[model samples]
Target: MEKSHLESALPIANERNKASSRHVRQKLAWALIPLTLTYLTFSKHSPHMSAFHRPAINYTAQCIQPSALFPKDTPELSKAFDFISTPTFVNASIERLSGAVKIKTETFDDLGEIGVDQRWDVFYAFHEYLEKTFPLVHEKLKVEKVNTHGLLYTWQGSDATLKPTTLMAHQDTVPVPAETIPAWDYPPWSGFYDGKYIWGRGSSDCKNQLIATLETVSLLLSANFSPRRTILLAYGFDEETFGYHGAGNLSALIHSRYGDDGLAVIVDEGASFEEAWGTVFAKPGAAEKGSTNVEITIRSPGGHSSIPRDHTSIGILSELIYLIESTQYPTRLYDENPYFTQLQCGAAYSPEFDPKLKTLLDRRLHSGSDETSTCMAKHDPLALEAAKKGPEIKYLLQTSQAVDIISGGAKVNALPERAQAIVNHRINVGETAQVVFDHLTRVAAHVATKHNLTLHAFDGIEEPSSLILTHNEVLDPAPVTPSSPHPQTPFSILAGTNRAIYGSEIITTPGIMTGNTDTRFFWDLTKHIFRFAPGYDDSEGKEGMGNIHTVNERVSVVNHVNAVKWFMLFLRNLDEADL
Candidate 1:
């Protein structure tokens, strides 16, 4: 108490010092207020703003300086650009049909023999439409009918020395289940054009490719643009029905006439450069993954509902699910993967991560944590992070499969003794169907034995072929070409369109493909095959894109025009290359 009183009496000078200290702190906070506001504004606005719009534009300008970015022009590059820009007769002919023929889906009664009669009607209608609409082109093109399913059009090239190039597309489309979709804005078969798109089933799928090839041929005929190589357009009618009678027979015919080595390049449809990925890299499919359709079944003795066995068929099926989830395929790098390295280069183009990326490219650093942390700091972080995580990330980057379909149970009260499940696997590149099946068998056996259950396997052992990229050296005979095989050019993956009929090859690229196409039949013919489409990247679910094989399917008018342009550029670029 005495000390407190003494301090209170002597605190006038101390009180003044304390007041000065508080005033200084307030002034310091006022000074920092503007800085804090500036930082908050910048953090919020930077991402949405383009580099050109930033307050500190000099940073972006300096980072993307002309010297550091792609060069303006060189003799070779100029040549390439000139070739890409040149107007071909093919381009002009497509412009003519750009407004003419209307392709629509053909409908049929859902009653008796719907499948057979509808397929026949669709085929005949297609043939009739070709005859009526493309009479002139049809007259010039040699058409060969194969059984009830396949059609081939041959346009002899001007250059007898060069091997022929075959452009392939399927005529048939997958049948729509009548119950799934109730109605369409334009009836599926109407082939309606709303001044901006072609509304129908096959517009983007194979019909687009079919029309483009025919248009190219028509233009060449009109302009007398004789190619040094031959051109053949092959259309398969039964492509939707596994291509057994369409592409299968045509491939056999090709093998008989040309042998394996005589044929130059057979282009079909598969992958396309989507805008989503193109934001990072211009290249689309350098390789596609393999696929296998598998069916698994478990059966037991049926019994009454009241007195059931300890382990019913449903119980056994439940164990199978656990087995599949627990086992996963081993992941590795694709040896023939030109796309991956090209993607890495594209990722390094931005200013912020260039130094760190260069270190990764040089293989001086192998730290995932450092790479991942650096990527998350960028504006476009997903793509960079995916690249840094390496092959495992890429393998699962797209929707690769563990399971798709599962079926079981018959009645409410019955102890069902039989259960089955069908799993469709879109295999990672470099992996085979047999390997996947072996893994499944092992896992299933382990689970079954552990539960004292009997497991019977029936399907899913068939192995589809791996992906392949055509080297310019191998594809020299083809007119369209790429500049180099430096893991960046589009032609690094120009295998024949039909990979399913051909089997796997040394030139193949390892990856996974999420969807199925007619190119599956070509795997029997040659392993040096790949599947891809051009014009637009429809990989990501984007607007202006149609629901493939569903009601109200359509393709944009702009996409159709660009399709013509891309095909022309691809042809000219390849034709001019020395290989």
Candidate 2:
């Protein structure tokens, strides 16, 4: 592949790792704060506990008590678990995943017009690989090809009354830089299994997930386990490039068939469990941040560099960028925010949680909105600490803006007629694209007035020396999935299934995905969407998860095996679940 091929791919691993690392650091910092205060007094009978801490106000009792559940231990379930646990089965699974990782189904941001782009031809080979490997799946399930490459598999159920369960994963991997190929312990696409990890690019990212879901279905087929509820498996081919051609098309078909909130529940690859504050914590994404791209173009009449005006288009663009960056969004902690619930869970369950921080959190949990708002506005110790942590910390509570792309003059001797920048914002919960539009409009209006330039915002008015603002790929924050303590709800069942596999001591809490997923396109299919992949998080003691989206990316055999087992159990539980 040309160097340009790698360059045009959407940025993934580095950005994801940076944001993930910062979030982890912020969590640790929250637990490390040193200050002691008396716990805020609250009536034991207080019924005003946030919905997140439903069924009780005392955090300790509710979150610590595990709600682990399992499907009735049938002979089929026992055989499936026993078979997956065996060394022979594990080695086979390793090979299964290794085979998938070896395939290069890389997707790029600029792989323009799918059918016209020969680059997309790789997915055809990937399709053959899937069909060839999972014969049982191919033979038993009804498969439909959406948008040529997207895969939708349906296993018909005996009953039509129950809603279908949808499982998702992406088929594409980000391009491996040609320059970084030599740094790998094993070749990036080798899928080399070193007794522990299957080393490759897609091993850790999504091939592990894709393979696990398919393998589980195949295993269940072998066990002759028929479900009362239908199961739908959808795999998008271009999730790395915003999934427009892949999941975007698949979701439209799903919506048309199922209608609004039609599916029983949708589970996709997302946040994994990590060790923190002396316990294993699984943070299945209950919500995800929205996203948008704002284009700011400053158009002017070009002139000789020697005869530059008071401000060229490039100069004005720079000033606008500065103003946009300087105007930061305030981080407001709401009682209903998923991260807030995560903190509450940590305080209640994490054995090593800092008592001082716990006390503060406890106080905030019971305090009135007026008091909390005042503290946040004043940048009190709590708010100050959060800000000091990093942008990822603030991002958990507020929208994030970054000036990612910028371009200007093509020649040194000539003033540029057009200068442009694209500002990317991951919209926070409780905010919309309009809020971003309004903020940018304010800044652009001020700059246009100061420079005495014509302004054209959102509507194109081709004119010289004018400032224009337009947006694309706008998405509002996903509706928050209910994480009620009621055991039968989708969140609880998923959480319970997590505990059943990982152990009762494991803490499962509702958390938000700071990054978006294919679930963004499937929001209409079901409100009960969960972005969780049952794998061990790459924390201090856990090294199973390799670097995702970069060289040496790999997934541990143990992680892959557990994912397969978990999927089998989760599906069985869903089949039997009344909800």
Candidate 3:
């Protein structure tokens, strides 16, 4: 799918949130290595548990430590903030972000291979821009460019025994549609600041995050703070697209160096805090649904339109599309889905959650037995129905299908020789790309049988008067990051940092990125991957991010500053930990 289509799907995706692979423990020990062998492999060929084989939900797990964990205050942290709080530093930070945004590092799905495509040249300019804007970063960090454009920066720690902490943000922005330019409040590339928000195409989706990490690192450098553990900053240039040229290559490099589970933790741009039922919830993406594009083509005899058959190739294609859409994937709420944890978190913590629903949720999640069957015997239907209340929640559980692109006849008088439509599917947790492919094959088979046409799918041959099904960009669902309830684990460290910065009122919970991110490539680097942007948003997708990927895309100055502070504190907290 194109980045624009992915962005258009965000309203449904961003509405909620992973399916995880291994259960995370508070501490890693040699004895546990054998147990985690399945998770450590990080390959689609590895054993994957279908939803049927998934273990029962242990509803009794703590969502977050009863109270937020706080890192001890240090002089370096105080000094870091002292500089960060200054009006001069704030202005400079804003300008640094604006300057980066003004570069127009837009990437599209159709971009050709690097070196051949002149468009890839823009990232070279972006690299130079980074050098000029943050000279301290360039001078101090060990910098290497992967596959020509992926940026990897390493801050060498005094000690190498501890795994490095990795932070990620993409450097590319979705291209602003030429037609949508008139709808934008400011030129998409202007990086306009109206004393409140930084406005641009990349402002909210990623540039805000990229600049904030730099600002944090630069400030840490100013404090002359030497880390006990190494720090890695990975910026991919093509996250807005399929990310093969960027993150895919970067991950291969990182994997070669770090081996499996080498990093202490990985933090990437994802969901920020969202408010619901008067209680604020900070959702960190711990899992992601898989995605693939299925293309269906129908071939038939072409003649004058006047002599067309009862149904033309285009008509057959339309029938297939309708059948796929009409037979929507079943919505199932398994205990293992990350969104289930979010629902449990709301029920456990939200003061204003629907009382009756809370009661039902409690009965479902906290049933006496650890087995899901016991709970499903009674409360499953009610809980599933409650979860379907909104599209945001619905898509989190359902494997989504949308017929995105279609094409057919070219001439008014001639019958079309071929018709094609691309159906996009975000595979639900506990499902594989094969599952979606099989579903498409079944649908096509039925349609072909009804129309007396030859059928072609994964195992079929193409012929005239045939219906063909093929897939591309097949991505199995990501391995779920192992989230922990203990205070000392990586998940808890992130939750603690959010509480330390945003305050104790916020309830941190595990969330799935309904839409995937660059972390999809870094699955082997760490089991503790966290997709969180530390900014506050009380009204979903509004306060922290303003219309991301569409017109008027912007990020608030307050959220930007807060993100800088959060990154600073998060590094300190991670550095002090024993994970």
TM-scores of the candidates are 0.65, 0.86, 0.86
Whole-model Cα lDDT per candidate?
0.51, 0.83, 0.82
What does the lDDT come to for candidate 1?
0.51
In model 2, which runs have C-alpha deviations exceeding 4 angstroms? 1-57, 61-66, 370-384, 537-545
* Candidate 3 structure, TM-score to reference: 0.86
Cα lDDT tens digits, model 1, 232-340, are: 6778766655565667778777677766545455567655542222232233343455566556666666768788877777777777776676664543333233433
lDDT (tens digit, per residue) of candidate 2 on 1-579 = 676676665466578888999999988877765421211123312323332453335776546444777887778768988899898898889878998999999988889777899999998988998999999999999999999999999999998888999999999999999999999999999999887789998997899999999999999998889999999999999899999988999999988887897899999989888676787788888899889999999998897999889889999999999999999766766555687777778778888876555655655655545243554355433444444556756788888899999999999989999999999998877667888988999999999999988989888665787999988778888999888856577777788888888788788888788788999998888889989888663432556546887788988887888888889889998899888
What's the C-alpha lDDT at position 140 in model 2? 96
Model 1 lDDT-worst window of ten: 468-477
Better of 1 and 3 by TM-score: 3
